[model samples]
Target chain A: MSEMKWGWPVIGAALFLLSAFIPLIADGYWMSIAVTIAMYTALATSWALFSGPTHYISLASGAFFGIGGYLVATAMSDYDLSFWLMLVVAPLVSALVAALIGFATLRLSGVYFVIFTLGLAEMIRNLVSWVQNNFLGSRGLYVLTDFTEAHIYWMLLVVCLVIFVFGWWLSRSRLGFALKIIGNDEEVAKHVGINTALAKVLVFTTTGFFGALVGVIIAPRYSYIEPNQVFSPELSFMVVIMALLGGAHRLWGPLVGVIPFALVWETITIAFPNSTTFFLGLAFLFIVYFIPHGFAGLIEKHWLRLRS
Target chain B: MDILVSGFLLAGTYALIAMGLNLQYGVARIMNLANGEMIVLGALAAFWAFTSYQISPLLTLFLAAPLSFIGNWLIYKFLLRPLVKRAKNQGQLEVDSILATFGISFALVGIMVSIHGEYFTYSFLANPIEVLGSTVAENRLVAFFIALAIGLVLYLWLNHTRAGTSVRAVAVNADSARLVGINVDKVSALTFALGGAIATVGGVLISTFITLDASIGVIFTMKALIIVIMGGVGDIRGAIIAALILGIVETGVATLVDPGLTLVAAYFIFLLVLLFRPQGLFGRRST
Candidate 1:
C-alpha cells in the first residue's frame, strides 16, 4: 500500500493506544462513559463499512450483536469454554447467518429490504425469547466476568482501530470501487460485469462479523444477558442514526457521528430516561431533514469551498 | 371448524389493518412505518373514552376518523411534504420516508408510554355470541362486522368514485396522472390521510378484542407489512384474502401447536412467500 493509504490507520492506531491510558487518569464513571463511546465508535464504523458504500441501510446489526452476546452467555453459563474461544465462534456464526439472510433478502428493492431487515431482527428476538421461555426454563443467561470497564474500553478501542485500518484498505481496494459503482447504480455496476449480489453479501457478512465481535467484547458488562436486552431494535436504529449522522459515505464518518451522539445520548439517558426513544426519533428526523449526508459531508463541503 | 370460523373473524380486523397500509404504500407511495402507531393511538383513544365515559367503541370510531384524518393531513402537509419536494427519485423518497416514519413511530410510542405505560384492557361487550354453532365473543363479532363495513366502503370508494379513481391513477403512474392534470401532490396527501383514518378505525375495532399496550404497535406493524406484501402492494382484494390466510395460519398454529409460536409461524410464512412469490399471491410480476 502507498504512504497515503497507510497514514490514517497508523495515526488512528496511535490514538487508540494513547486512549488506553484513560483508566489510570480518570475515575470509574468517566471510564464507563469512555467505554460506551468506544463501543459505539466500533459499531458505527463497522456498520458504515457496508451500509455507507452500498446504501442498504441494514437494521440487522442488533441481531448479529445479540447473537454474539447469546453465544458468550450460553457458553459461559452452560459449558466450561474460554471467553476467547467464544469470541471467535460468535462472529463466525453471526457472519454465516448474515450471509444466509443477505442471499435470501437482498433481491428486494430499497423499502422492502429495509423493512425485511427490521422484521428479521424482530423475528430472531421472538424466536430467541420463545426458545428460552420453553426449553431453557429461564428468561436469560448469566455471563460473569472480572473485566473492568477500562478493560472493555481498551478492547473496544483496539477493535475500532482495526476496523478503521481495514476500512482504510477497503476504500482503496477493487471491491470498494465496485461497491461505489453499485451504490451509484446497481444496473450500471451489473452492466460493467460486477457481481453486485456477491459484493453486497460479502460486505454484509463482514459487518455481521464485526457486529457480533463488538457484542462479545461488551457481553461481560451486562452480567446477565436477556434476548430483549441484547436484541433491542432501538440499538439497531441508534447505530444507523449515528452512522448516517456522521456520514456513512466516509470511512471515518461513523466515528465523527458516534462521538457527539454518544455524549448527547448519555445526557438524554440521564435527563429523561423514559423519553430516550422519543429523543431518538427526533434525532432521526433532524438528521434526515437537515443533514442527510452527516457531519462528514458538511466538513467536506466547507473544506472543498475553502480550497476552491 | 371453530378455529376456521375464529380465524375468519380475526381476518376481518387484519384486513382492515392491511388495507390501510396498502392504500398508503400503493397510492401515496409512502410506506408509513408509523402506521401501527396510528392503530395503537386509536385503540388508546377508544380505551380512554370507553373507560372514562362509558362511550361505545362504535361511537369512538366516529370520533377517531375525522381527528386522525386532520392530524395525518397536517403531518403530510408539513413534515413529509418537504421530503416529497426534495427527493430526486422514488428510491430517495422511500429511504427518507422510511427513516422519517420510523422516527415518528418511536416518538409516538414514547409519548404513549409517558402518558400511559400500563397494559390496558376493558370489559366491553364481553358476552358470548353464537357464530355458526361455536360461540365467539360478542366483542370480536362486533369488531368483525365493523371491519367488514369499513372494508366494503373502502372497496366501493376505490372502485366507483372519481376521486378514488384518480388516487388509483397516481398509484399506477404519477407522472402520467400529472400529465392528465391530476394534482399528484394533493392526491397523495389525501390518500395518506385517508389511510391513517382507516388504520385508526381498524385500531378502534380491534381494541375491542385485543389487549393493548404502547409498545405492541411494532407487532401490528410487522403483521400489517406481512399481509400487505403477501396480498401485493396495491391490491385490495388480494389484501383481504392474504389477511384471511394469515389469520387462519396464526390461529391454527396457536390452537394446534404452541400459542407462542404464532408469531414465529407468521414470520415463517412471510419468508416462504417472499422467497417464492415476491410479487404476491395474486399479483402479476411487474415489468
Candidate 2:
C-alpha cells in the first residue's frame, strides 16, 4: 500500500533481471563463478534469516546442504526419480531433520548450542560419507541424467527469488519481532511471555529448509556429489563470512557479501592457487577489524546520513 | 597394563591442551577460535628448530613455549585488545572474535603449508624407555612428565598466588575487578600467555606421536574443546579429570571401533552430555 514498502521487491526484481542476463554477457568461466555467487547468496541469506535475527547459531547448514545433495543424487541414481521430485523431497527431508535436531537442542544457549549443532553436522557428514563409501561402493555420487548448465542457472534464479521473497516476508512478520526480542535478551522475552524455545526451533527448521532447497538445485549442476564438498566446514565458514561481511540483520547482506567474495576468490585462485587462503585470511581480518559494519552497513549508514 | 600406561600418558598431553583452552575460555572468557593455530605454530616451530639445529625434542619444548606465548600475546595486544575495547560500540564482539580467529587459523594454515609443504614431516628422537613392562617412546614419556610438571605449576600458580586472585576476580567481573583496583588488561594478557604456554606443551607432545602438518591443529583444537566441555568450564581440576576420562574413552574407542570413528563418538558423547548437563560435568550454574 505504501511506496516505501514496495521498494525491496522492486530492487529484488531488478537484481533478478540483471542476473538473468549475466550468462549471456559473461564468458563461461565468469558465468560459472556468477552461478557460485548466486548459490552462496541464497544459502547465506537463508542462514541469516534465522541466525541474524535470533542469535541461535546453527553450524549445521552444511549438513543440511549435503543431505539435500545426497537426496537428489540417491533419488536419481538408485530409484530413477525425476529431477522435479528430487528437488521437492530433498528440502522436505532436510526440514524434517532440522525440526528433530531443533527440538532436541533448542533449549541450550550460547557456546553449548553452537557446539551441539556442529557435532550433529559432523555426525551426519560422517554417516553420509560412510554410506557412500560402504553401501554405494563409491566415494561420491553422480547424476545419471544429462542436463545443461543453463537449466541450472534458470532453476537457481527461480529458487533464489522464492527464498528472497520468503525472507523479506519473514523479516516483516510478527514472528520476526519475537525472534528479535529473543535475540536481544531471552530472559526478558521469557518474562514477557514469548515462547522463546519454540520460536528458536521454528526459525532453525525454516533456515534448514531454504539451505536444503539451494543444495538440491545445485547438485544437478555439479553432476556429482562428494561428502567433502557438500559437508565441509568451509561451507559454514563461507556463509558466516557472507552474512557478517554484508551486514548481518540486513535483507540483502548475503548478496553484497557473497558476490564480492566469490569474485575475489575466483580471481585469486586463478592467479596464485595456493595463496588464496592467505589472501582470504587477510581480507577477512581487514573486514572484521576495519569494516566491522560490512558493505551493507556502510550503505545503510550513508543513506541515513544523506536523508538526515 | 599397556593400555593403562598409554592412556595415562595420553591424558597428560590432553590435559595440557585442555588447560590452554580453559585459561582462555574460562579465565578470560574469550573464545579464541585460533587456539588450535597456536598449537600448530608451536609444533611447526619445534619441528623447524629440531631439523635445522639438530636439537633434542626435549629442549625444543622449552624453546617453543615462550615463542608461542609471545606470539599469542601479540595477537591479544594487536588484534583482540582493540576489538575488546570496541565491544560496547560494536555489540558483536563475540561474532567478531570468531571471525578474526577463523582468519588467523586460515592464515596460520597457509603459512605452515608454504613453509613446510603439504607433505607430513616426521620428527622423533630415536629412543625408547621400558617402564612397567611396557615400552614407551622416550620423547612421548618425557613430554608427558613435562606436561604434568607444567600442569602442576599452573594449578599452584592459579590457586596459591595473589596475582592468581586478581586474575580470577577479573574473570568473574572485569568492571567489579577494576572497582577493586585490579588491572584487568594485565590479567587478561597473563591469561593469554599462560594459555599459549600450555598449548605449546601440547604441540610438543602431539608432535612426538604423529607427523607434523598444517591441518593437524583443527582436530586437536576440536578434541581440546571436547575435553574442556566434558571437564567443565572454569574448573582446572575438572579439566584434568575430564581429560583422563576422554583419553581413556578415545583410546578404548580407537582400539575397539574404527579409528576414524573416534571424533564422531566423542562428539556424540559431548552432545549427550550437553543435553542433560549443559553447564558441563563440573561447572557451576551461572546466575
| The candidate that achieves the highest TM-score relative to the unseen native structure | 1
TM-score of 2: 0.94
> What TM-score would each prediction reach against the true structure?
0.97, 0.94
Standalone chain B TM-score for every prediction:
0.98, 0.92
Residue-wise C-alpha lDDT for candidate 2, range A133-198, written one tens digit per residue: 766777457775565666677777887888788877888787888889988888898999999888
Question: What is the C-alpha lDDT profile of model 2 across B85-149, one tens digit per residue?
Answer: 87762235666676777788888888888888754466586487887998878776877888899
Clashing pairs in 1: none
Q: Tens digit of lDDT per residue, candidate 1, span A15-106?
A: 77778888899898888888888888888899999988877889988888899998899899888788999989999999999898888777
Question: How far does residue A3 in candidate 1 sit from its true spot (Å)?
Answer: 8.4
lDDT value for model 2: 0.77
Docking quality of model 2: it rates as medium
DockQ of each: 0.73, 0.50
Task: Provide the lDDT at B213 for model 2.
Answer: 81
